[model samples]
Target: MMKRKILVLKYSFLAILLILLNTFNVNGQDEFVKKSFTTADPLYTNLLKATEGNFKNYPHSFLENGNIKYYQIDEWTGGFWPGSLWYMYEYTKEEKWKKAATAWTNSLESNQYNTKHHDIGFMMYCSYGNALKFDDNPKYKEILIQSAKSLTQRYSPVVGSIQSWNTRKSKGDINLWEYAVIMDNMMNLELLFYASKVTNDPVYKNIAINHAAKTMQNHLRADYSSYHVVNYDPKSGKVLHKQTLQGFSDESTWARGQAWGIYGFTTVYRETKDKRFLKTAVKMANFFLDHPNLPKDKIPYWDFNVGQPGFKPDWDFDPKRFKETPRDASAAAITSSALLELSTYVKGKQKQKFYNAALAMLKSLSSDTYLNTNNANPYYLLKHSTGNLPSNREIDVPLIYADYYFLEALTRYEKSK
Candidate 1:
């Protein structure tokens, strides 16, 4: 009789512990969602004040002199501000945010035909993509299809990848790169994949698949760390140079580039349901999460190999100043958002691991260390993002895309709960 009583007591205690753990998880998610919107409300309002209610120019980042920098509709970052507004609208279902998002998104309509670069995905999809999610506007679909068509103009059958940049001289190199396909190009595949799904045309999806396969073949190192830029021979379709335009060195992995790879590959897997892309994404994510240089808070330095021996760039800045290196909250935001989606695709321990990592990133980003609560940079949300360290531009500043993905991660986290 005593033994039976003890067993019952032990089972009751275990059940109560499980209930407490579940409640704690739910409360934690609720806290993050509440804090995220509370901070975003003021930051976006300040952006409106700074811009004087003008939706023509998109907020990019703060300049070194502490002025808010604005980009034209054609700039690569043009979509993020509108995308963020759409996220706000989605979360609150407020007509004011919807109106604001529509106004900002309308400013980029001309970008539908922009074929000068491969960032049309970032420019058009991010803005219109989120807009279509909330409102079933036929015009949005039309614009997105046209944008996808324009993006295909950069795709080369020879290289089996979209050209990121036209013929241009890389920094510190005298030879002009005939064709460059960057890790960032992987992100643009989503627009193509979407186009394929909406229109039921295999052409767009085929291009995206070819690009992903080629990128997997050449852009990733053996350990899944990605190269920032891979220059190719336009005529021969041969890889001429595998280099870094934004990392600490040609051999070092740039944090944002790696984040792009993880997010991009995960997206491809989602669109195609191909196991190869999923495998690649898992490997790349593990590389990032397991890297030795990642900070305790999960925010990464601009480059993974910063201050590591023999990983110096030809730029003027000293690589030995890794301790003083700027942390990229943008990378953290992007990775957190991607990890949320990735967690849904996996099961068991991997799912828990990815979800926990995303939660940690959100916790750190929402903390005082990264969140901009003082309105010091009225136009941006999160701080400490490094845009381009080699050129010494926008280092340790609040970037617009950082806020976009941070809000996205928050919304995803709330939904997962």
Candidate 2:
């Protein structure tokens, strides 16, 4: 009798799983064909013009005719935005699109890729990650796996979190103590999680959970605002410094980092069923919703805590002493995509509001005046974008990721509607 009951229970769970998969059409014929910004919509057309516009400089990379080409956006090999045009290809299925994505993915196989940043999600997941998961393109899976391995190998048992940026003053010297964690690293957790899934080893999951927990403990303030970086001892996992590497948050909150925290925690909650992570996501998201300083445009300045209207920076707070914060469309686009995901976890009107806010941001982003309508510039985006202002790269243009997520949010909005 006991054996029979156990069998029944197992089958019942399997039946429910079948039902959910059927309901969501998880294996349906339709792939998540990426959407394009370049409809009759001026936003997309203008972006193409802007990014492709300048005769001397174009942020171009791709494999074509059995060769790869990369142009210098500047001193930095900056603006590697394959993820942006990947979706454009999804919509059009043009040979050029495939060639472009293929070239970018192939180049890394021969070169030492940038492995030590929180932006693996922005770099790989948005491009190769999606390509493998949705399209079953085995071509990119090896690279994605290599990418995950690269990120995971950076993990230090002493710090108990993934090493984010490499701080090597010399070549071949591994004494790099400079460690920091950014909210953007949260999306990269998927890389580790995938590694765990494929290897059937639990180590990756544990590392992901631990990294997230540490971020919550060390990087966040009481009101759910966040700092951009937490420096730590790699040997002992000690907090060495909490600095705002990006925005206002050595003591103030970066709007983009806050958005990343909210979105990333929500993702962790989805994976682990951790109540604390879910609650933290809610807390930070609500803080964002409640801020009165957001412009009529839902898009935010790169740092919300800076330059509140009618309020002067304290004498100690000098805007001129530091670089003025930029308005980051890329950050806004990532935040909106996160909110769409968060809606899946809430109920009724509570869910509706989060859903609406995300939609509002999309509407504002793809607007005619805000979009990059200049045919001279081949990038297909509009307002509030900055790439490598520190390096004076693409000072204000429609970033590739901005275009990617803006398209993603619009597609998600289309589905929810």
Candidate 3:
């Protein structure tokens, strides 16, 4: 009789423990969602107030000297503002956010035909892509198809890659590059893949596959760390240069560029179901996550090797001026969103690792250290993003794209739960 009583007590205790754990988990997610909105609602509300319905002047970044910088509709980051608005509409189902997102998304219609740059995907997909998720407008699909067509105009049959930047002299007369492809260009291929799916044409998908294959071969190192720019001979498809235009040196890894690789390749794997792309994405993700220089908070410095021995760049900045290197919240945000999607593709411990890492990054980003609670930068969301640090531009400021990805990560986190 005493043994039976003991077993009953043990089982009761186990049941209570499980209940408590489940309740705590649910409450934790609720708290995160509550906090996210509490911070974002005011900042985005202020953004709309400041703009006063001006769709042409997209919010880009908050400058160091206390000014809200705006980018034209044609800029690389033009879509992020609208993308964030779309996320807001998705979360709240509020008409104001939807109306604002529609107007801002409509402002960038001209970018569908922009063939001069390789960032049309970033400028179009991020906005219209998210818009279509809520409303399946045929116009949105047609616009995206046209954007993909324009992007294909920059592809080289010989190089098997999309040209990132046109031939131009550097600071000096450095025209050694006939064709340049940056790691960031991996992101633009999604538009082409989407176009192929909608149009039932393999031409766009074939171009994207060729570009991904060539990039996998030439742009990534043995450790999967990527070069910022890989220059190719236009006529022969020969890799002319594998160097850095935005990192600490020719050899150092740029944090945002690495984040772009993780996000881009994961996206490719999603669209293609190619195991090679999945393997590459996993390797690149591990490289970023396992790097010793990655801070405890998961937000990384502008360059992974910054201030370390033998990693100096020939830029004009004074290293001594900054007591600690600047962190790129944008990198963390982008990686967090990518990891959430990647977690769905894997199972067991790998899935848990990615999911937990993404949560940690989101936690750090939502904290007071990174979240813009005081409206110091009224036009932007998160702070301490490094954009083009070597060129002395947009350092340690609030960037629009950082906010877009942060909101996106939060949305993905909620859905995964």
Of candidates 3 and 2, the better by TM-score: 3
The global C-alpha lDDT for each of the candidates, from Candidate 1 onward, is 0.90, 0.63, 0.90
Question: For model 1, what is the alpha-carbon lDDT of residue 372?
Answer: 79
How many backbone overlaps does candidate 3 show?
A: 0
Q: Residues 231-336, candidate 2, lDDT per residue (tens digit)?
A: 7877678887775545543576677678878878987898888989988887888777777756667777666767665433222445564363567777777778
lDDT of 1: 0.90
Candidate 3 on 1-417: residue-level lDDT in tens?
999999999999999999999999889866876687677877888888888768788889986677679998878999999999999999888999999899889889999999988999999999999999988999999999999999999999999999999997543245576899999999888999999999999999999989998999998999999899998999999988777778888788999999999999999999999999998888899999999999999999998988788877766758887878999999999999999999899889989989999999998998888988777776666889999987888888888999999999999998998
- Residue 8's lDDT in candidate 1: 100
For 1-417, candidate 1 gives per-residue lDDT tens digits of: 999999999999999999999999888768867877878887787776787667678899887677779998777999999999999998888898898899889889999999999999998999999999888999999999999999999999999999999898987875678899999888899999999989999999999999999999999999999999998999999999888889888899999999999999999999989999999998998999999999999999999998788888777877465567799999999999999999999999999989999999999998878987776676677989999999878888889999999999998988887
Which scores greater on lDDT, model 2 or model 3? Answer: 3
Ranking by TM-score: 3, 1, 2
Provide the TM-score for each candidate, comma-separated. 0.94, 0.74, 0.96
RMSD to truth, every model: 2.3, 11.9, 1.6
